[model samples]
Target: MINLFDTAKRILNPFFAKRHLLGDDNLFSINNILSKTAALAFIRAIDKGIKEKIEKLKDIDWTKDNTLPNFPKSFLDEYGLEDKPILLKKNIIEKNKLNHPDITEEEARRIIGNALYKPETILKANPNKPAYHNFISRTDDKHSDIVLLELSDEKENYEVINYHIINNPARDRKVNIHKKS
Candidate 1:
């Protein structure tokens, strides 16, 4: 006996839409590429010159890359991300250190703020480091990744124990918050 639902699915299946045959890993790799694609587009939107640099990311096969698997199609495909981003929120976000899971968007300031703001200190401290100072052991001391450890019985899966670095751009990065006259 032929089921109507099954018949309809055969007619409307996404597999036939893009000539993409499905495998367990296939969807995941495509999702990874999709993420990169969206991020690259965002970068391109910010700068005309960046358009060319980000263009290389668009060439992904989608049927190949092997990174983020089982991504929500609705989010990645339709919206590219959350409508209300956790990272972009205006409120100060801190990083936790014990469990090591919660990575926030503000983390970039660790590098940018440090590079642009603390370049002198970095250079001064690492006089023998030469011009190409990438990172030092102090990076660990400066920033942390662990958010918090977990308990077996909590309603929430993980307890987020966010910790802000003492010298975070949020706190210490204030003297030059605005343009100087």
Candidate 2:
């Protein structure tokens, strides 16, 4: 078996040499090489952990808990709607779960609920579909969850048409800026 430590050293050696030669104080400081190397290793480890978690999620038997959860009364009250069953369909769950293997059913529910309660951004009367509104909420540093709600002709009924995770570099940059604050 290949030694990971040796492989990593081989890979990083060139990068370290280039950084040391370039001598860019802000971007790559030779004086901070040890710290930078440690930070990079930590980031890689976290990324690997996330990938393993996602793989575990993909293997889960979704059928074990196929029951659709109902939107809470508080969620209904926020939109000034009567307390009625507005459940997420199994097909939607299946589709989203397949699309975003990194997100669990409970995490998906929490993301949707959080978006409905306090969305970071809302695109009302979306150009593509005037009846559908997009609610975006940042889930983590790397992912943002979007919930699309379609208003019925009567304007009283709101149905969630779609929910999915998005990984946009620009969006992540904005999120990172906010996180810094």
Best by lDDT: 2
- Give the Cα lDDT of each candidate: 0.29, 0.55
Clash counts per candidate, in order, are: 6, 0
RMSD of each: 21.1, 15.4
Worst-scoring 10-residue span by lDDT in model 1: 83-92
lDDT of 2 by residue, 41-98 (tens): 8446644643443344333344543323333443344444564334345576677777
Q: Candidate 1, overall lDDT?
A: 0.29
> How much is 99 displaced in model 1, in angstroms?
20
Candidate 2: the clashing residue pairs are none
